[model samples]
Target: MRTLGNILWFLLGGVFMGLLWWFFGVLAFISIIGIPWGRSCFVLGKFSFFPFGKEAISRDQLTGHEDVGTGALGMIGNIIWFIFAGIWLALGHLMSAVACFVTIIGIPFALQHLKLAMISLAPVGQTVVNKEDLTRKY
Candidate 1:
């Protein structure tokens, strides 16, 4: 089921979305100071590619401890990201979501887009993990 959904999503518009993320990530990397944000972009970009069966969760929650990415620095990073690239990515996702929502068969994809939109708002400190991992003892 997840494979089918991911294939459909990739075929529909996920490729574009993921490319946008990677584009931004490259830009951020070139800036040097934006390396952290670039790293987040790459990670989230992969997540954007095939989101089914995977979930983005707070790194702190997964580790049960705060790291650099789960600290105040992460918050600041997110704020900067929001001001620069986050808003645009979220907008893209939102527009895609609206278009998907127009058809019954697209409802699920629309929901996925909505989720991506939210994540795009503040991707810092988040880590993608398989759904099955969430239930495992770490």
Candidate 2:
């Protein structure tokens, strides 16, 4: 099931998503100050390429970061991101939506990518985990 979904996703518009992520991730990493944000984009790109079998998890649960979105530093960073990478990522997903809509089989995967793209834009402290990873120790 996942294999089919992944193949369809790639055929429809996942390639665009991967390219966008890789492009921005490189741009972010090229600047030393954007390293952390670049890492987040790279992580998101991986999921964008193959997302059927995974889910996004809270980074706090995985990394034990307390007060991430609420702290002052987090807010400032999120605000800046919202204006910058956040919006671009959202747009990427929107483009995927158009690609998916062009055909019947592409619809479901397109919707999935659209949803995932929303999450990617401002991923912040979010983490992607396999759905069955609940059995694994964090």
Candidate 3:
């Protein structure tokens, strides 16, 4: 079921979103100082490809300890990201969700877009994990 949904998502508009993420990643990479943001963009871009069976979670929650990405620096990073690329990416997802909501079959896709939108808003301290993995100790 997840496979089918992911295939449908990829065929519908997920590919475009993933490409956009990669594009942002490339732009960030070119800036050198934005390497951390570039890396996060690539990771989230991959996540955008097949989001059905996975979720984004805070690193602190997953590891039971605070890390650089889950601390004050992470907050600052998120703020910078939100100002630079997060707003645009989140807006794109919101628009996609709105378009998907036009039909019943698209409702699920719309929900996924909403999830992506939320994640896009503050991606720095988050990591993508399988639903099952989220339950396991890491």
Candidate 4:
């Protein structure tokens, strides 16, 4: 089911979103100071590619430790990201979601886009993993 959904998502618009994330990642990678953001973009790009059966969770939830990406610095980073790129990416997802919502069969895909939009707002402290992993953690 997940595979089918992912395939449909890719065929619909997921590939374009993933490419957009990757493009931003490459732009960020061009500067040493933006390496961290670039890495986050790459992670999000992969997540955007096949989001079904996966979930995004806080780094603290995954590692049980407060790291740079999950602390005060992460908050600052997310702020900077939101000011710079997050808004645009999230807006793009929202637009896609709206378009998908036009059809009943696209409702699931639209929800996924909404989820991705939330992640785009503050991706620095988050990690994407198999949904089953989230279940096992608690």
TM-scores for all predictions: 0.93, 0.83, 0.93, 0.93
Q: After superposition, how far is residue 73 of candidate 2 from its true place, in Å?
A: 2.1
Ranking by TM-score: 4, 1, 3, 2
Candidate 2 worst ten-residue window by lDDT: 62-71
> Taking the tens digit of each residue's C-alpha lDDT, what string does model 4 give over 8-89?
9999999999998998899889977889999999999999999999998888877776553566888898998898889989
Q: Candidate 1, residues 12-43: lDDT per residue as tens digits?
A: 99999999999999999999999988988999
**Compared with the true structure, what per-residue lDDT tens digits does model 3 show for residues 1-138?**
999999999999999999988998999999999999999999999999989899898877776775545678878989998999999999999999999999999999999999999999999888999988876655
Give RMSD (Å) of candidate 2 vs. truth.
2.6
The local distance difference test score of each candidate is 0.91, 0.77, 0.91, 0.91
Runs off by more than 4 Å, candidate 4: 65-69
Check candidate 4 and list the clashing pairs. none
Q: Candidate 1: where are CA atoms >4 Å away?
A: 66-69
User: What TM-score, to 2 decimals, does candidate 4 have?
Assistant: 0.93
lDDT of 1 at 65: 68
